[model samples]
Target chain A: MIKVQQKDFNYSLEVAALSEGNHDVGGVCAFSGLVRDLVGDKHIDYMTLEHYPGMTEKCLAEIEAEAHHRWPLEKTLIIHRYGRLEPGDQIVLVAVSSVHREAAFDACRFLIDFLKTNAPFWKLECTGGDSKWVTAKDTDTQACDRWLNGDKKE
Target chain B: MKILYFSWVRDRIDLGNEEIVLPENVTTVEQLVNWLQSKGDGYASAFADLSMIRVAVNQEHVKLGHPIGENDEVAFFPPVTGG
Candidate 1:
């Protein structure tokens, strides 16, 4: 499942419901991303996110399909929020369930890494009465590229 | 053709989207950037550095040599910062 919304989400409830009633799924791996309080010493008051309407959803769906193709995942969930979000708010969540722990863990990390570099969302940082657009980091591109070269087991 | 700008490009260009006619001989994204620079000061400033910008043809991320056609949705923006 994939969802992009502006409302707050309950991580515990969402993960529980995703893994419920799946006997074959012996392991579940999940990751939740939260807004950090500091960025290069800037105190962030809030972040305003914008994304393309139809394109953003389509891009995420493709990423999810890629993960399932590479791993034997029983279930997967991705939730990303937009609009004005303050520090300590949840930004994104990824959960993967599989019969084995390795596939579950790998798929969960793959989803988040790809989302960082490939997603269409844009963030504006509001700090100390000033607002500016954040630039893409080279580290994010490197992280996504690591998956293209080989799997974690390699 | 529809042209969409995102992130810092949208902020600098002062608009998110617009419609324009593709100039002749502007087959690739690089050529299109040069054509756009001549439209106005804002367009020139937004596309100042060709290397720093990224392009997409019909919502798919593309390279500078990607082909663009009539009725296609073209987007230009800075590198993504989402995670």
Candidate 2:
């Protein structure tokens, strides 16, 4: 499942829905991203996340499909929220379920890493009287590239 | 063609989206960016650095050399920052 919405999501509810009645699923790995209260000692009042309406969902679905193609995932869920949000608010969720823990763990990592670079969401940090758009970090791009560079475990 | 801008690109260009009819010679994304830079000061400033820009053709990511059609939706934005 893929959701791109302005409303925050319940992580437990999403995980329950993903693994409900799936007896074969032995393990699940989930990762949630949250808005931080500070950036370099500056207090963040709030942050705004913006995304392309149609393209955001499409890109997320494609990323989910790629994850499934890579690992034997029994279930997957990706929820990303946009619009204005306060500090500590949930920004995104990626979860994966499989018959074994290894697949679930690796695929969950892969999903989040790919989403960092491929998704269309942009974040703006609002600090006090000033605001700045969050710059894309080279570390993120490098993390995403690791999957394509034969960094996977055999 | 429908041209879209997001993030800093939209802020610099001062518009979210616009519809335009592409010229005969503007058949690729790279050429379109070149032509758009001549439209206004905002366009020139927004596209001054191609390295910071990323493109999507019809909602899918593509390279600068990607071909474009009149009906296609092309978007320009900075590198994605979401997780």
Best by DockQ: 2
Q: What is candidate 1's lDDT per residue for A1-154, written digit by digit as tens?
A: 9899999899999998767998998899999999988998778899998887777888899999999999999999999998999999999999999999999999999999999888888899998889998888888888889999884632
Docking class of 2: high
How do all models score by TM-score?
Answer: 0.96, 0.98
List, in order, the clash count of every candidate structure. 0, 0
Pairs in steric clash, model 2: none
Per-residue lDDT of model 1, residues B1-83, tens digit only: 89999888887789989998887788888788888888888888899888789888899999988888778899998887776
Residue B51 local lDDT, model 1: 79
Scoring each candidate complex against the real one, what DockQ results? 0.80, 0.91
- Could you tell me how far off, in angstroms, the CA of residue A87 lies in candidate 2 after the best superposition? 0.5
- C-alpha positional error of residue A58 in candidate 2 after TM-score superposition, expressed in Å: 0.9
lDDT tens string, model 2, A105-153? 9999999999999999999988878889999999999988899896874
For model 2 chain A, give the 10-residue run with minimal summed lDDT: A145-154
CA error at residue A117 for candidate 2, angstroms: 0.4
- After superposition, which runs of candidate 1 have C-alpha atoms over 4 Å from their true positions? A151-154
